[model samples]
Structure formats: C-alpha cells, structure tokens
Target: MKRCLDEAVLQAYLDGELSGDAALETQAHLAACSQCAAALNAAEGEGAFLAAAFAPDDSVNVPTVQLRARIDAAVARLDAQPETNARPSGGWNFGALLASFTSLLTFTPQRAAGFAGMLSCVVLAALFFSIQKPSPAPNSPAQEEHMAFVTQPPAQPKDGSANVEVKDAPTAPTPEINRSGVPIQVAKFNRPHASKPRVKAAPVASSLAAPVASKAQPLPGEKDYEQAIASLSTAISHGGDAVLKPQVRAQYERNLAVLDKAIEETRLVARRNPKDKDAVDFLMSAYQSKIELLTTVADQAQVAALGR
Candidate 1:
C-alpha cells in the first residue's frame, strides 16, 4: 500500500470492487498521493465520456402520419372485400361454396334433390349425436351386491320385556353381503378420546439396520468440509459485518444464500445415490466455492488491517 497504486487497482477502486476496509485504504492512498489523485480524475472524465457516448437516444422521431396512413389504407382494403357472412378461417368459405353451388346446378333436378336430402340426413344425424350425452351403464349383480344397503328386520328383546323393538343404530355403517352370501364386516374407526393399549414394538437387530444406517452417514471428507465451513462462519460472524460496508455485506449474504441452496440440493442427490459422480462433484464444487468466498473475505480483512 506504501508504493504507488497501479492504474488497474485504481480502476477497480473506481468501479467499487474494493469493499469494506480495502475501499478505505484506497481512499487514504488517493488523498496522500497527488499523482494518483490526478489519475483518478482522468479516469472519472473517461468514464463520463464513455457513458455519454453509449447513452440511448430518447429523441427518436416516430413517423405518426406515415403509420396512420398505412393503417388506414389496410382498413380500407379490408372494408372493400365482401364478407358474405362467412367465417375468417375455420367456417365455410362463401366464394368456394358459391362455385360448388354453380357446379351442382349442372345435375338434373331429381338427382340434385336426392343428393341434397341424403346430405341433410347425415348432417342431422351427426348434430343429434353430438348434442346428446351418453347415459351411464347399468350396474351388474356384483356392483349391486357391493352397493346395496342392508336393513335388518325389527327384533324383539330376548328378556321378554313386552316386545321392545330393536333397530340398527343410525351412526353405524351399513354392512354389505358378498356374492357368496357372507356378510362383509365394516371397518369400525376408533374415537379420538378412546384409550388403547400400546403394543411394544419388537426389538430390531442392529445387524439388520446397520447397512441402512451406514449408508445414511456422511463421508469423512464431507464431515471435514462441514466442520471447516462452520468454523469460518463463526469467525466471520464475530466481526465481518463491522468490517464490511453495507453493500458488500448484502452481496456476501446473497452469495452465501445461493451457495447454501446449491449445496443442500446437491447433497440430497449425492445422499440418494453415493455412486453418482456428477452429484458428488457438484456438492464438492459448491462446498469449495463457499470456502473460497469465506477465505477471500477473511484475507481481504486481514490485508486491510495490516495496511492500517
């Protein structure tokens, strides 16, 4: 930082590439170095000139009179063509229909009448079928058996209590009889407040589940990367925001979010199939990129502190 700053560095500074303390150092160096200050002014002038040269022209003149005239001419041409009550594309064309009708006149009256009657009958039949909806098929004996509602006959009390009528409860589901005359038992649902004895699950042998557990476990390399990332994150959180400018901190946060999402997605893919080389590669790449980003910020902070 003591040496004269290069034009490239100055350009990066002017372009806002130098963030947090790095930007402060550049500002301090520019203040003390008159030569650099002149160079900065020259850079600013060039930037302004380039921006002005590339600026879009807002004074483009549209030929309203010519456009209006062309539109009006098109409308006049459309109006000159006869519509003859024909549709634009899908419906029958009147001009073609007129030619067909003229050709039809060459046939004798009786032949023409017979042809017209046959065409009318076909058209009527098609219209009738298209307008009507198909009726549902009648249920067979098996379907009737499944769908029939069972109504038990009234029963008297077995205790001979003056013929008390016993009826099926309204809340109970209607049981249906199968084709073999066996009554199908309706599945009864337990009430929400019903207390039931919990059956202890049989102990699963470790050997049976060992392979699945091992498969779910992360690799040694991934574990190391995760530990390193966690440590770096903790260090950055301690004073990173204080050292970073608002804009730089925001940019870093956005980058971290994107990297985190990519890492999570790729990690799932890799976990689903460890043999997938592409997925493993993508996961590792995301981790590496995140590491590089954190490393860059940490180094930049360190360098800026040394300069101070």
Candidate 2:
C-alpha cells in the first residue's frame, strides 16, 4: 500500500469520508509523516472554528419538508434550461456568472443583517457628527443692525492735537434793551480784558489717546503641541512630589486627558504609518500623562496623611 497521500485524499481523511483500503492507506501516511499529521491537525482546527462560528441556531432550523421542496424546485429549474445553446449570449460568461452568484450568496440573510447593522452604525455616526458640529447662526435683522453700528467709524473727538480737530459752538443772539427811555443794542462778543492778554488756551491736550503698545504676534512654528505634551509628561515623571498643589493637580489632570486623546489619534496614524513622528510624539505624551497621574496621586495621598 502506498504511504503517500494526495491532496484530495488528505482532504477526505480530514473530513473522515474515506473508506476501505484508501482510508487505511491515508491513515498510515498520516501516522508516518509529521508534515501530513500537522496539516491534518491544522485543517481540523480550522473546521472546528468555522463550525462553531457559523453553526445554525437550533431555534432557526429549516423543516425537512421545506428542504426537500427547495431541492425539488432547484432540480425543476435546472431541467427547464435548454440542453443546447443556439448562439453565445453577451450577458455574462459562465465563470463570471458563477462568481457573481457566489458574491450574491455572500449577502444572504445573515450577511445582509450584518451589512444593515454596519449601515445603521454609519448613519448614527453621521447624525451624531451633525448634531455635535458647530453651525453658523442665522442672520437676524437686529444682528444686522448691530453689525452695521459696529462697523461704523468712531466720531472724531474735539481737540487741537494732530489727530484731533476742534470746532467752535455758534454764539447766542444778543437781546435789545431800553434803559432810561433810550434804546441800546447789546453786543454778543465780549472784548478780551486789556489787563490779561489772552494766552490762546494752549490747544487743549487730547484726553482720548491711542494705545501705545501693539498686539504681540505668534512666532512661526515656534510652539509644537506634540513637543509641549511630551515635555509636560517628562516634567510630571521627574517632578514626582514637587507638583502637589491643588491648582497644579487640576491642570495636570486636564493635560493628561488631552494627551490621552492625542495619543489615541496618534495610534490611528501609526496604523497607517509606523514611522510617523506625530504618533511617536503622542506616545511619549501619553507615557508622561500616566507618570504624572501616578506621581500626583502619590503626593496627594501623602499630603492627606500628613494632615491626619
């Protein structure tokens, strides 16, 4: 008896479908060949996994009569096809048709349920994003009016300074009066007292002034958030008990949360590119957050114990 096993024979042995001499020969080959034995073992393991993963539920079993009826219907459909082809059709080649049908089978009720679940998840995600996203507020007439007012230039102040202009007020009308039966006209302009020569009021200095300090501008690429996070983490790790204040603890906790989120984002990037520096930077930040948390907690506990 030949001790060598062909692929089909090996498969049959794995399935326990072989019988008589062939089965005995396959068994002998499996016993003698470590490679064949390992292959068989692997095949059994895979089959067991599939069986457990895809086993039909007892609650959803098909009736024997229904199964038979389906088999009969399929047979009838096959018989109805013409035995000979009159000419080649452009619809689809046999292999392509089979592939398409196989693909369609992949979308069976179970698979279709899975696809529906996935679609529902996507829709829910989109809805959540839409709800969470910030949107532009609708323009209102009041808001428009307010905007117009805001956009208008400020009224110029009255002063004799370079940036200011002073305007004189209109003089009041003088009234005519009769005194001692004689009519007299009163002048509105008063002549300056000869004794005090008018020192033209030194042009009133401007009370309203422009800000002397200009706004500060950020430097180009000077501050990196990733490097900042990493530095924060290093500080937490090294500082240990030095950062024990409540305010410092709160700030550290907040930064830790940010670092955690950043690290998660970096991990997603790392999935695409293992060598991404951003991912590495985020990882370092995450490490720092952990260390900081531990150190802060330890310090806080020590402080509490000392008070007791």
Candidate 3:
C-alpha cells in the first residue's frame, strides 16, 4: 500500500470524493504531512463557511419583465419577414450610381484639381504595386557578373604531363530590363573542390547572463520622516482638521522644513562620495517627500472642484 498522496488525491479526500482503500491511504498521508493536514483543515473550514452562507432561501423570486420584453420584440421581427427557400442575395448593386458620380466629377470646374489629384493617386498606386510585386526574379546585371566571376573555374597550371583535362564553361545570357525598369539575375556556382574544406562561422556569445543582485539599504531615521510627510499629505488631500486647524498645519510645515534640511545635508554627503548607498537612500527619501507634497497640492484642487 503506497502511503504517498499527490495534490489531486489529497484535494479529493478533503472533498470526500475518494472511496475505501484510496481514502484510507490519503488520510494516512495527510496525518504524516503537516502541510497537507493544514491545507485539508483550511479547505474543510472554507466549505463549512460557504455552506452556511448560501443555504437556499425559498422566499426570494425576482421578476424578469425586461427579459420577456426582449424575447417578444425578437419574435415579432421574425414573424414580419417573408418566407424564403431560395439562396440568399449577394452584395448591393451600386455600379451604375458610382459610374455616374465619377463622370459628373470629371466635367466640373474642379477638373484641373481633380486631374492633379488623380495623377498623384496613380503615381502612389504604381509605387505601392511595385513594392508589393514579388521582387523581380534577381535579374540585375551586377549580380549576374558577380555570379559569373565566382563560377568561372580556377585556371589550371599549363602542363602537358598532367592527367586531368579542364574545359571552359558556356556563358549565361544577359537579362532584359522591363519598361517599368526592374532588374533580374540568375545565380550560378562551379563544382566544389574536395581538397579545400569550407570553414563555418563561430557561434556568438550568450547575451542573457545572470544579472547582478542589488540590495536596497534602509536609511537611518528616514522612516520617521516619510511617515510624517505621508500623514501631512493625507490630511491636506482629504481636507481634514489639519487644514482647518492652524496648530496642526504649523506642525506639518515645521516637520517638512526639518526634513528638507536633512535632505540637503544628505545631498552634500552624496556629492562628496557618489557611490555611498546611505546618501543615495537619503536622496530617494527626499524624492518620496516631494511626491507627497505634490499629491497634497493636487488634492486641494479636487476639494475646490467639489465646491463648484
């Protein structure tokens, strides 16, 4: 009897879906595994809470007046249409109307303007058609010349004593350019020599190296400053007693000024030593305080909007 239980088996047991030996085995596994036991307990508790919350109520029955109205409207529409056993009609017939409108437009005082527009349109259409046309079958004269040069067999050493005989290959015909002016070429290659081995390119280095982990250091006495700023911002934004009460507003301003001085000192330290983490931490704290100040000002605007 295997004592180990998978997540599904454990869930089924919790759900009371397993039977006999399988159920017993799951129960035994749960007893041994603390994590599984805790999960099963949570599931059972959730099930009990749901059962209590959604126990059926027979007293509530909402009417469907809106649903009934929609159904009636749809039925009425279907009843009004004539019966059709033939194939459905295709697209709308507007060819004659379009031709008449085009003819009228061509004869007006706007004819020159129309002709310029038409010519521009024709040029644009030709340009787009040329771009989309399958690139004219590589028939450029330069490409053909390069291919011929590469395919021409290497000149053999002139020796009557050599066993192998070399023959000159036939030249390819030049490609003719179309009036639209597009070039095309055919690529050619000579028989590869067995004596010379082809060298393949080396594999490139990987770009996805493990990133250096950066640990953010907590600035000393900065948390208190942030909390003060956050509190003042929240109070001003919400239009609470802080704005209406002079004493509270004065205290908020004083705390902000003190934090500003501390920030300046931190900035000076940072300027002296650029890589100091503490100085960087203090600068970030200052930025957080400035954000809070802006947030407070925006909130005051919202309060004014409410008055209007």
Candidate 1: the clashing residue pairs are: none
lDDT scores of the candidates, listed in order:
0.75, 0.61, 0.63
| TM-score of candidate 2 versus the correct structure, residues matched by position | 0.21
Clash tally for model 1 = 0
| lDDT of candidate 2 over 107-161, digit per residue (tens) | 6788899989999999999999999999988653335435644675554434533
As a TM-score, model 1 comes out at 0.31
After superposition, the stretches of candidate 1 with alpha carbons farther than 4 Å from their true spots are 1-216, 305-308
lDDT (Cα, 0-100) at 68 in candidate 1: 100
All predictions: root-mean-square deviation over Cα? Answer: 41.3, 27.7, 44.2
Number of the top TM-score candidate? 1
Off by over 4 Å in 2: 1-4, 57-59, 66-308
lDDT per residue as tens, model 1, 119-227: 9999999999988968889663234433432332234434434523444444676788999999998887745553443443333445435545654778548998998
